[model samples]
Target: MSLPKPVMRGLLAKRLRFHLPIAFGLAITTALVFKYTVTEPRKKAYADFYKQYDAVKEFNAMREAGVFESVRPSGE
Candidate 1:
């Protein structure tokens, strides 16, 4: 037996309604997984670098070596 046009339309609408959210949720989950996988290593590397790096020590060493003295402004 053939379904009426209205019945087919209703069925199509119901199917779309049921599957749309699942598709949306899967897309979001996949994007988040890829994002974290790509960024986690970079973030960890930055954290590790910062943990061992000290700006003050580097600045003081540069100053003691007269690196900044030549570049210093006369007014300063």
Candidate 2:
């Protein structure tokens, strides 16, 4: 059994009128929530971690930990 063409069209129009706005609203809300929850926190974490970054100290630490095969140059 199938609905008549006019009834089917009316039902489709009704669904579009109601559900389309709801779906669009939910998508926008979800995107905003994800940005706040994930993107903002990740950016803050990276900024904090790099705020005190030291290059020479890290290099020395890696060298001490046998990460390098070549000896350090006799400049220092």
For residues 2-70, could you state the per-residue lDDT of candidate 1 as single tens digits?
966665647878999999999999999999998899888889999999999999888877776668856
| Candidate 1 least-lDDT 10 residues | 67-76
lDDT tens readout by residue for model 2, 1-76: 9966665647888889999999999999999999999999999999999999998989888877778778663343
lDDT of 2: 0.87
Candidate maximizing lDDT: 2
